[model samples]
Target: MNETFKPGPEAVEIVERESCFRGFYRLDRLRLRHRLFAGGMGPQISRELFVRHDAVCVLPYDPQRDAVVLIEQFRVGAMDKAANPWLLELVAGLIDTDEEPEQVAHREAEEEAGLQLGALWPITGYFPSPGGSDEFVHLYIGRCDSQGAGGVHGLAEEGEDIRVHVWPLEDALQAVKDGRINNAASIIALQWLALNRAEVRGLWV
Candidate 1:
């Protein structure tokens, strides 16, 4: 793919940032020291209130049969916008301060999808919503046996009622067109798989 957006000519520095709260998650109020721009001149950019987080999403692929595993859960964020708040999504979770992103992907797969992930392959690392939230998601694709994947398993303490769904590559691709798989991470994962299906499937056997 051709490059869409290149980096700006320059960036400003953050003079200081203070934490408003440091309970479970810390919230910060930032102040920028200087400003700069791209293409000779641009608007003054300010730095403030950037929420930092580490997240992971997995695209579970069955290389032998060319399939994928997905999970369906009720998303509170989408509840207000969607007619059906319950959404079908890829397995994902936040990386704790003590845990690595790959480890988080493995744990979430077992907790949410009841499958073991093999050879964690990093797809990309990016910010899902940079304009408002400082959340960064590390995306991955893990090989698995999709034939026998079953059951609904979720964390009882977290009240997660997630159902696992094993899907062939074609069916999941259709879900994207039908507007069923709506989330950004999930959508990106599927599209990536679609592009690289043949190579991915050749790995297991």
Candidate 2:
């Protein structure tokens, strides 16, 4: 903890909140005021935030082959900004009320990639876009056999059409560097593995 970092929930005062929309997802408008760093309270501000469920994202890694599993799927939100809206990403799913984060990781691994995970390593968690969204992502590195781990798999009823890919660790990192892997969760997970590969391999192998 740094001494200069002192921001907390206590610093914010919520004056009012209203539900703006509710569907598969949610949106809320909040009227609030926050304590200023230099002196006193700041002016009231109104902001609409995207309310989302916390999700678990796992990078299925095979230490034996030094490879990783990635999934490709269509993203409507990125349709405008991305060269291709169908982007490569990690296996992920929202945490259900009856399940834990690790459970969701394992289930999503099987659902999205058709692979079973072993020896899960908790990496880190973060908010993808705190400015307008309250979506938090729990990241992990799940050990698995990447041999012959490429194919198309997803639950059709859920409107999911996914393509699974197994890439060598070097090539995957290169994808990250070349900006091919653009999603936040996948990028963070891969970069974390890049920084701590040896430690993770030592622990799993």
Candidate 3:
């Protein structure tokens, strides 16, 4: 794969920007223009972007038990489209302060699953929905003991009612295959583990 076409941030032009909403989550309407593929400036396009702080999601894996820890919680956004609004997801939290992504990952692991992570392996980072949202997610696979992982744990002040579940690696992958695990970060982390489990286990050992 030898290619030489790269466009940087300098290629985009921000003409105007205005705040659309300023609540828990923010929405910004932007008027911008970018260089077209044919080598010219495109027309100014106006779009609303959902702005959110960066977040971290960790797939807590217990290699000794060959199991993974997951959390179940209610999601309002999926209420209309999903059969059940309560979803099985990886331990995740937003970077609300000056804490680093690794710190958020560890903190969320304790808060959501009541487990302490061991070795942490960075999987990848991505924008869940770049077309409309600027929510960047840093994903990781964290080592943990799943024996005592299941329970109802969450911060009451945050309105979180989370149930922890420990699933065998095979079962988790099956859920991913059958659409049971539909969250983007969870799906990506599970699939990545499925492909790299041997290497990860070796490293952990």
Candidate 4:
């Protein structure tokens, strides 16, 4: 790391950009170059970037019951590499225009799992993929009452048919170890819970 060479948006220069595809999601072609770590700017190159709205994901955990609510959905993106395309994931939704990330978390939890979440604990915010996609995610663990939080719920108009699952906290963690819960956001949240379960429980209980 250089003392004066800071890494920021200004370090990258977008020479030219054009929309490549736009439908549900978007794609853009960019010719760009950026400041190099060793010395000067890297060579100008072409790249196709996947464009998507910033999104939010919340894992609903019941501190009293020591359980977590997760959802299973068909992910077309995973079809090529995964043995089973349906992924067990946190309740998630895109941050709509004028909608706060926390609001999206609460809304998706109810929409996908029938659970009205309590106070949301910030887990971490990250880019699920930065190499090729502009998909930033805000992750959270929302305290909830998971008394009856299992179902098949999703918006039909959006063609979503999601299956909700309530797992004991340990089981969810084990699923991650067993490679069952392979999605990035879910993996990150569950790992964080595994490390900070007691403190997180104290936040609600």
Top model number, TM-score = 3
Candidate 4's residue-wise lDDT over 1-24, tens digit each? 556688899999999999999997
Residue-level lDDT of model 3, residues 1-205, one tens digit each, is: 2134347898899999999899989999999998776677789999999999999999999998889999999999999999999999999999989999999999999999999998789999999999999999999999998886788999999999999999999999999989999999999999999999999888776
TM-score of each: 0.84, 0.95, 0.96, 0.95
Report, for every candidate in turn, its global Cα lDDT versus the true structure: 0.82, 0.91, 0.93, 0.91
Which candidate, 1 or 3, would have the higher TM-score against the true structure? 3
**Best by lDDT, which number?**
3
Clash number for each model: 0, 0, 0, 0
What's model 2's TM-score? 0.95
Can you write out model 1's per-residue Cα lDDT over 1-205, one digit (the tens) per residue? 2244345424445557787777646778766543322233334455455576688999899888778899999989998899998898889998766999989999999999999999877888888877656889999998888878978889999999999999888999999999988999999989988887777767655
The best-first sequence of candidates by TM-score reads: 3, 4, 2, 1
Pitting candidate 3 against candidate 4, the one with the higher TM-score is 3
Q: Which 10-residue window of candidate 4 scores lowest in summed lDDT?
A: 1-10
